[model samples]
Target: MQETRDAFVFRGGAMAAKPEIGSHDIEIRDCDVKYYTKRGFRFRDGCYDIQVINCTADAGGKEWYVEAFPMSFNVIGGAKGTNVYDHDITFIDCIASNNWHINGDSYWNGDGFCAEGTAYNLTYIRCESYGNTDGGWDDKSANPLLIGCIAKDNKKNYRFWSGAPGALLWNCVSAEPNKRGGNSDYVGLWTKGKIRIHNSSFVDSSKPLALNDWRVTPEQIANMNISVNNSLIELPEGKELPAPNYTVSNTVIRPLNETGLSANGVGYKKDMREAQILLTEVRPHQPRIEKEGRLLETKPLNVFSEKNPSGWYLSDWNNAKMKIAKGKGINDSNALEVSTNGSKGGGATYRTKRDSATIKFANFQKSDWALKMSIRTGSTNLSGLELRALTMAEAPKTKEVPLPGTLNGSITGWQEISIPLAKLKASASEANFANFAGFYIRANGSMAGPLYIDNVRLEPMN
Candidate 1:
């Protein structure tokens, strides 16, 4: 980095953005930063839209592996009136390993990945941390979300907070004993906000949670909405804690889509867990996409939880044969099927739950997403198939934008499709997209026979 920067230093030093002074798009992928003196890749001084993917910061001799400073700090002039902070920063499929200073002027802040005072709009997906003095991810910032991320053998697996009052952690894994393999010696995850955690796995890390959980008194509970749904945990014997009210349901001591979780200290490698139970999935072992691809905002659209959400009704095959059958899905046991003869084409209607149990998608109308699905179609030639998300029954989202995208009916067996969310149409307000109706599957305007579906999800693209 030093040699490269020196060879290419412009008028403004090696520093890329003054943040408060401007904004820039910085993308670094599949690179390594090791044995740096000050900080391996430092970002400071204002609002920046930086994306670092499939990167690693290891053996940094100083402060942090990867660091970012919001636009407000101790400078000559200062950033008092400047309201701009580090905004739209994302790290995908990255790792920070052994990034702690043994002895130095700034040994006090030797964290794997940290933001000193306050930062915002930060997202960490499919990242890893190991053997840091402070913690894996010490997010002193606001509105930081961690998805499909993992931490092990660190003093603290995660330390996160937000300016607002919520933490969205989905499908993550943690095994912590402070990198020293001792009990009650470290925290799995420390937080200061409401939490919506689902399909995650927490292992034997001294103190599993440092937040207000089932062990705390009523007064000790943080004044926040806590929802821990469909997860797994394994504590030291005799340390079984009470289940929090927010737990939709959970289990213990089961391999919940996790591996390489032994007591032996190890660095966070690429992901091998192959499952898409959450909105955005970050895995170490992937061949389809590169380590660093799109830094866009990804969210999982459909979350068919443990029990199916109420209010959804099935259509009895107009031109296609559709029925709610059992035991045929990609991951789950249940599935929806459409089967028939190829002469006359017809399809089924799949809509969102309109009843009290309707599950709504967050940030739907706000950002763009990629519609994804897994389907096994039988040998049939369906003329037309459409995937739609909207409220209006007769019209699409808007004329300029169509509600659905035409599907290639000639294909067979299991396959996946992703469509741009921006192309979706709506007749009403996009805000609180949850307010709109659900996603619909209309197929077989002309086709031969069977269509099987499962694991339908939505991911944020930006």
Candidate 2:
């Protein structure tokens, strides 16, 4: 549990190698080191469980060359071609800047950090790397995870060629806005092993590619259940391409240049030349949660099951009055009562006068969750569905969040809607209860129009 600080300011190429440091849990915190004549911080033979937090290292070099020995040096080093392994190490909130090298050179002087031989379980969280000549992160080991990290204006943001497993890039952003001197081969992220990229963005780079050829064969594509959702991939003009080996959903992919599609006897403009259209679809296989006993059920909600009548439900009222009509379905016969007013329009408007049928739950817990429901226009009079959570003995109060406004489409089909639980809690701050109660859905002022709802479920995250 001991903390140490070693802010050594080494002269360029003038520092000598230190003796081996024994294995210990070390925390290198808030240190500013620069201009190392050699490697900045060498992990000695037995150094393990090292955590570097909020540190900054500026490798002062314009171009990396072995001959430029006095001015160019790597930031960290372990003996090359050795069997030494660095494991359980994390670098959080750090910066590695101004490390550059000549184009097309394979030297090690300009890399932010180089991990050789069996390095495992290493992570870089919320770190920044800029102006690095060679690459932002070069890992030749296994089990490296980069989360919420940024590497901008670098020759290569990531270059990993070693045989490693669990090499992942999650919520990372790689951008290269400058396109000069270098060949503009600004690959935002490049990996050569098993990699999983989720919820990440790549913008304005020469080539943003993911290389999975190391482990994946052409035959495996037929037997995999894969899905890609909620990702944004943008490229410089003329570089728009389809995502590899997955169906794209709720994603925005736009290339900078004009291109065309030549498939399925249909052709369309690419990139900026084509109009940007919004298309939304829902896959039924994704799980939804429900309340079970005294806890939120960890299983997906069965919207299609007859026992789980908690499926998406909707109704509509005519005019400005709140009332229940013959078209509305009621789950609890006695709880729901509606009334209508003949306001302004010839069509009668209805509103909910009491609680509707309750979707029973076992218990409630304070956790992050999600609820998704689909709403479709049944009769078209600009209707909406309202959801509320209430205690067993009291009148149910409205849980109003910034749900999507009146959807516009034909009154013939369903539209899928996903609402995050955080957003719902924030908007309905006054009505949310601590105990696991129940939830209900009611329509706004009843119009003559019909409102169809389906696919309602809750999702709880650990």
Candidate 3:
């Protein structure tokens, strides 16, 4: 297949021209696509009941090409808040390989098979993905099933970040990951949702398995219930699997010792190659403050009323500084003193922790909930100061509101800032803080000196 860019497109909903009937109930059989500039076979949102049988996709993007693109076979879903999605897809005996890209950074793309967004119920049977720059199977669907599939010599073999009911892998194999410059092969399976692995094999990975917790709710994490049954998990010599938070039953763990051939007649270790994927050093475990059973109280949430900055942090900290001290706030109270080097992305943030529940305001009849804070700036202008409300979705839906009434230089002492929730609701109609992750007081390189903030809290309008 050859095209100007992004070849072989199949889109559903308004993306399709003319009648705009979404691409659905389609079958692609015995097709071979190769040497495409981007996306050998693309399936967009609203596509459903699609089948690809006995197909092959290779060399999606040229090597060393400076561009950011997804997999050769991409199934991307719709935007958040839109109910549209791609669903009920099936792939049998398909192969994707040698897809790559280069963006000068240590990270780029060329994933072999990527299914993202809210796409649901995708099944891959007897598929083989190998020699890709990025993940062999980068999935974020609500529910995906993989049976008898093999992923080899890719940067990351499998990444599962699904939603409710999670994903399943049965009789699958991930082996012989590409190791560049003597670094350990990346994680064999990186998961973030409820996952059940049965009769699978993970071999020769630097890290056999790793878990993620980004944008995932506490309830979801509690219900993740990761179970690996009757699986062979192997890591390189001298590497130890981290003590898992989930259950690992009937799974074998051992040092990487051997290699073998796949059902496709390709040696699992023969095509050891390098490609651009997110290169992340194994992260240290971040301990969360256990709330036990303490539920969040949004009506009178004391975000920063404490005498110390326990949960507050500075954003863009590479060129920023945060100081928590008393006698530096309104009425000589405890306050957060944030100083930045006029960097582009300096800000103060209060990120919610695992114990914090979603801040919901939809049940209230009155829309008088407000984010209250006391601020005193030592900068030339508060022009670029903003209050950004963040969400818990993977691609978060945020609301950014500028601080009203610009001050020329500095405030005399303290000024009370009361931002109405109704205004935030009007700005982002779909955001009611049900998925409220946290808040950010952004500086945006507009501050001349330090910004002092105190008594940040959320409550109804007085």
Candidate 4:
């Protein structure tokens, strides 16, 4: 394939003058595509045995699926919010790098591989994307299979938008997420489908798996059979990220070094080379992974009344400046603000004043519940906000279990931080906090300064 600039002569404008091809196999092998308006190459009406092999695309703009754009493959097309598909397409050993450019007000720029509007049964073997504006692969479809792919230095890496079902990621790597990205590189939002990721590595993303609590449900994800198995991830280097969020099922996390995955592939671990084969061969002690339990409902967290009886009162944080701006809450309009200036030894604790020793719990299992709080920081600095969960005792004791990620985010707008009730058990005795005084927060060691918190409530895990 000789190098060419703007080699894309095929164009799809309103589907009026699209070229009609034969019904036989269409193959574009070992070619270089450059600069086009809508897409580099497209096959709108679909064909039999479509193969894109050893191709490299650059300078293509506006929804350019350098490899494939299923459903509406022939153009920069498809109605937004429509579920459509194009099928039986395969891309092998291709590279879609720097295929980013802006042409018009309506046009957007850059994507390594993109699928939209119900596209299905597409396969990419050993493909990669780099320096794109959007991400490595932005998908919104069903039954797409990817094997041995790589992504680097894009706004976001693997973005799984709303899709039908059946998405697979195998032996892929997403690294070096652009600092300006709000979510991490491996962003997963669509949860109503069956998604499986195995023997892959997600490197240098702070929050690799961020599915919004309001948008997705555990039952929805579990019912869809979404599982992340034997994957490795590393936090952003030298940065104090809270921790990676793991809200999926059947996830077994291992380190890169432990897998013996050196740069040379010297170790040749069984997990990577024979992953698909080993999945079929399980031992006796192994448990067959399946769907999680039934989902729960969510509601407003109505607490802290004027006449406190359940011992719910505001935290009198020591050496901290605080305020209560009425009518600024999340659902309402009142929010609490706190700035830590003189916190010592474990920082300052902003906990509720207690009187009664215990409060009652619902009949749901502990893991079925979560304490949700809506908080946002004024600056990109305030971090280290810990929600305190205490057990009712002579001196209410805190359990020693690992908590969820701390409130270390710096989002400039309101975002919810959910602590799964399973994580609130500081010790084995508090496993089921039936004898609970109540909850509060430890606001100290303000990394970036003052932060605002509101809409503190206990709701079912959604």
Which regions of candidate 4 deviate over 4 angstroms?
Answer: 1-24, 60-84, 101-109, 162-164, 179-193, 212-226, 235-462
lDDT tens readout by residue for model 2, 1-462: 111122332211110122123244777888776754344444533245667777776756553233322211122222222223345566777787765555443443356655654455566677777776667776665656666677777667776654424355655666663323444445666655445554566666657654544466776433332232454566666654444544456555666432322222221112211111110011112111211112333544433222223223323334433232332332312112222344332222112222112222223334555566555564465445455443443422335543354544444455666665445453554444332233444445444544444445566655
- What TM-score, over all chains together, does every model reach? 0.45, 0.43, 0.53, 0.43
Model 1 lDDT on a 0 to 1 scale: 0.51
Instruction: Put down candidate 3 lDDT per residue, 146-242, tens digits, no spaces.
Output: 7668888787788888644667776678877773322224667777776777667887666667777667677655655566766777756676544
TM-score of 2: 0.43
Better of 1 and 4 by TM-score: 1
Worst lDDT run of 10 residues, candidate 1, spans 69-78
Q: Rank the candidates by TM-score, best first.
A: 3, 1, 2, 4
Candidate No. with top TM-score: 3
C-alpha lDDT of residue 385 in model 1: 61
**Candidate 2 stretches greater than 4 Å from native:** 1-22, 63-83, 103-109, 162-164, 177-184, 210-229, 236-250, 257-462
lDDT of 4 by residue, 308-420 (tens): 33334444445555557665566567677666666441322333443221333422333355666667765465544555665544432554332233344544677867776
List per-candidate RMSD values in Å.
23.3, 27.1, 13.5, 22.6
Candidate 3 residues lying further than 4 Å off, grouped into runs, are 14-21, 60-66, 179-185, 213-225, 236-244, 259-462
Per-residue lDDT of candidate 1, residues 408-431 (tens digit): 455555676666554565534443
lDDT per model vs. reference: 0.51, 0.47, 0.64, 0.49
